[model samples]
Target: MSNSGMAIRPVLWDGDVFRVLDQRLLPHKEHYIDCDTSDKAIRAIKNMAVRGAPAVGLTGAAAVALGAREIDARDVDTFMKKFDRLCDRVKRARPTGYNLEWAVEQMRLVVVENLSIGIDAIVEKLREKSEALINEDIEVNRAIGAWGKDVIPAEGAVLTYCNAGGLATGGYGTALGVIRAAWEEGKKFHVFACETRPYLQGSRLTMFELLKEGIPATLITDNAAGFLMQKKKINVVVVGADRITANGDVANKIGTYSLAVLAKTHNIPFYVAAPRSTIDPMKSRGDQIPIEERPGREITHLGGKAIAPAGTEALYLAFDVTPSRYVSGIITEVGIITRPYTRNIRLALQKEAGK
Candidate 1:
């Protein structure tokens, strides 16, 4: 989890400035954007400079702290009003990723609890809390890795979608974290990185990370997944989630649902690795989870070259929901949640609260 080694982190807090690695230009360019204001942080999230559910959540917390440092309010009442507005703005940055709202609420609690002390003290507390969120993200991902690693076969193949590596989160990762943990545990396995279209996070970012770590991985077209599964080349399917409803339905990259369905047909165990913050206990079902529609250009073109005729309308849903029935289990930092997910998810969350 520490970058002191060879790992590169997507998010970092350098003194008062928060830095995020720009993922849009990966596998060719490595760029870091320093966000000194809440507006800058919000823009980074919106523009995809910082992505993945956990990474954005951590960024949201940092954004709140950065906003707090600039607050000019002298009274606690005015400070609360302004802070609440700031939290609302961050929360509205993205709808699919529950982690953003969860992180914002976490940061809000810090401000509310310390408001009686004064704005300066409250800002200081926010700073500490934000930093803790970042550090805790790394720890949480590592814990997820520890728990999910056991699910990996001793020697087989694992199929993963998108770029759920350190580049996707605050430090280690989620699905890729489990992969890394399993590899570190001396489990020999091959990784299939699906070339997730539109964004191509897997082909670009995931491949970059695997190659950097010298992990054995193959780049496959998104549609080739079913063939591989049919051939029994895939042992398990693991992906990270943007949000998980109370019933355990998963919301992830647009192609994730297809992968889950194929895995189900192939009788392969499909797993979702994420931090507890990714779960939305309030949402009873997947249909209630908001789906973000991205620009049509993303689906109509590739690398600035049009794949379709100009003005050809395209649907660009950023994510899709996979029913809990297709999921074999939900991997979290705490542990894996099996069926009867509604009950197990609540029990797991309760245990996390007690901790």
Candidate 2:
């Protein structure tokens, strides 16, 4: 949670206010959207002002807590009704990331347990629970880094797609965390960041983090990834997941599947790094995971400029699923999950729970 002295944090809670780093305008403009109400927080998440699975989850919890404080309910019953509705609204803000639902459920449990105490007590508990979630996210990410760093080569190029650094989570990142940990351990290597199209998160956010931390990194276009691997420049591929199905399938950025396939063909290690909260045990397979579709404007334009003709229409799929077969391993907070991911993921979660 200390951030290893990093300057940027995606989400911050100071007193009653939630200040979120507006990721939509990153790497250039730095601004925080002040959210005092759940609606404001929800909008931030919906608009990509505050994104990433872990960050969204933390935002949802904070929203519930803020909603609990803002709702004008005279009695416990009325308060519970309003708060529960707010929880559902926040959960629905984004459908693909299980962390959003997972965080709401965690906050809901806090409300349920303290409902009998009084409305004020419930509100206070919600605040405490929301803070707990934020702190837990950073801790889990650090643990994930410690567990995953071993996979990084001693001196080789490590490729990452999208933005999964401090800007994507409460503090440390999932895939980037491993890279940072490895770098901290004196593993001198170059990092290749893919300029993820449409969103350009890798170019905008990931590159920003790497530069900030003084990590050696190079930016490449989305299409240039295969060429880099073919030239034997990239050694391993690591990416963060939005949701991991029960069968070990991963749903991440739209182009993640293609990268995974390329890594498999090149016989390179393809790893997914994320906390256990991202693993949705309810979804049996990747096909079962809901892929959120975005507006055509995202694809038809770039940086607020229209690049296509007026009549052009584009289908924007926010995420794509990668079958477990292509994944060399899944790095979690507890440990690395290898083959038979179903069994390993279950056992890892069970162990984490038992702890």
Candidate 3:
């Protein structure tokens, strides 16, 4: 996913020991750690080496598909059992992002749906289908960017929280893609990047990515968004969604809800840039969106540096939900959707989903 005219990010491959841009080394050393085993992949996902709902989901499916290749199965039923176990294992790695679990379940459904095909063929198709899912994300994100670009002001500042860029997707990113498209269209705008707490994905990843593209951006402490709003440093608050409920409520980075609130008080436009896949029509509202409770170590330390006394337990939440009512618009790859997204958005997505 290219944000602000950066570059294309490749999808996870079997032989490719999927390396995560060690978020811990960010703002200093931009490093990527290689994940070679299911164990390594599990650790990476747990450690936030690989995150973002879409990326994690893709990785979970890829990990299972690759793990299936390693299973020494003598028969089709054995392969099925082993593969099911593998998916279950990946599902346990992270339970917050329903996407990860959802993808695994989806892959399983694919396997079950095509059960008529032998295990040998099933394995091959899983790999093929998983690869296609990654490709589909890129295409969807690109379209979302194209569509989101129209909603952004021609010349104004845009605000975002957390990391939603090439590093966060199998290809084109949702929120970052919109920024990239706008930048490419000769739009001169400053990007206000919030330094998300616990894990500063914005300070570490988002800022680094924008700098790579030489885009103009300002770094602000997550709490300072309200001040920025009062000062009128921002015109729009654009965030990426981990999940969007049927009512259009969005689950995103922890600080996103605060930003949405600030934007609402300041009367600024708040938008959610995501692909149709991010929307969960099954859930009725934000109350159903699960929040990721992170390890306490994140709050007590900044990267590898200690910011608190030794062994200080800290409360950490990886996500928060912004009520749909607070959102001005939802910028999807398809287009900008307004309130009452009920029937239209779902119908459109259902059509795209082949439902």
Candidate 4:
């Protein structure tokens, strides 16, 4: 499939040598950053050249494998030691998205699994698996999109927070995936995208994506959501999750919790679109999921432009959690999981993982 001026290959794609969509110059300036070297890859990730949980995760493996390919050594031990350091460093670029960490862990397992299997074999398997990780996310999103399409009312308004669109995942998306499916299904649903304070992922990215697809949408400030809801405009709330706890708590773009609260006050249904892997069993509750506090500059600026004159301080938080009680359902690739997540989420994962 192809979109506007771009090709829709598998979700996990590679741009020139090492360049990724320069999100900083988006919706106005279309650009990509090149990072052929491991060090350069680290800088790209650190500077937000490439982001979104699934996107970053695929990039993580790509960067690591790219680094491994650059390793120069005759001795396997020496080569492994050197590449390990590079891989570990790249993994540190983003500490919040578990996908980055998850991809790294998968890459490491591939290396171990291929031991005594020869360098060529190891590299081949890693490459295949890395690519598969991306395709896996794509397939999951497609399934999620199909199954999640029904969550939205047949003819009602829906609200989404942040930039969980095709750019956020391998291809289709997460919460936005549902929207895509709805569009495909000929559902005439109105979409309200939050500007996602401090980051503006919604305005800068989500809006861009929806417009690209010719989807009907309206952009609004994060605070103005309640007013729209008060007018009985928003009947359902659908957002993406970076991480979800065993207890059903969700962590996503910072203003998401506020939306959830507002939805509850207005008796609107709040829903979360997330992949199964995001469900962390180790973390028993939302409190355990690591909430990333971005640099203070994010709150004081826009698109690398300083809104507050020079030297003004900024307060930034990359994510926030919404308790399960505020959410009505969690749509996954397998099916939709409704409230009372304490055990149902865990059980759902077990059943799917069993497959």
Choose the strongest candidate by TM-score. Answer: 2
Residue-wise C-alpha lDDT for candidate 1, range 1-355, written one tens digit per residue:
3332227778888888988888887878888899999999999999888889999998999899999888788799998999999999999898899999999999999987887798899998998998898888888888888899998999999999998888878778899999998988889999999999888999998888888777899999999999999999999999999999999999999999999999999899999999889999999999999999988988899878999998999999999999999999999987899989999999889775224
Checking candidate 4 for backbone clashes, the offending pairs are 11-170, 18-35, 19-33
Native-vs-model 4 lDDT? 0.78
What TM-score does candidate 1 get on C-alpha atoms?
Answer: 0.96
Give the per-residue lDDT of model 3 (tens digit) for 41-80: 6777787777887888887877777677778888877888
lDDT string, candidate 4, 51-104, tens digits = 677777777887777677777767667767876886788778876666777788
RMSD of 1: 1.7
Count clashing pairs, candidate 2. 0
Q: Against the true structure, whose lDDT is highest?
A: 2
Report lDDT (CA) for all predictions: 0.90, 0.91, 0.78, 0.78
Error of 1 at 189 (Å): 0.7
- Model 1: lDDT of residue 158: 97
| Global lDDT of model 2 | 0.91
Sorted on lDDT, best first, the list reads 2, 1, 4, 3
What TM-score would candidate 4 get against the native? 0.91
Q: Give the deviation of candidate 3 from the true structure as CA RMSD.
A: 2.6
Worst 10 residues of 1 by lDDT: 1-10
Expressed as tens digits, the lDDT of each residue in 1-355 for candidate 2 is 2338247778888889998999888888999999999999999989999888999999999999998898899998898898889989999999999999999999999978877899888888888889888888888888888999999999989999998887888888999999989988889999999999899999999998998888899999999999999999999999999999988999999999999999999999999999999999989899999999999999999999999999897999999999999999999988899989888888887874314
Which model is ahead, 2 or 3, in terms of lDDT? 2
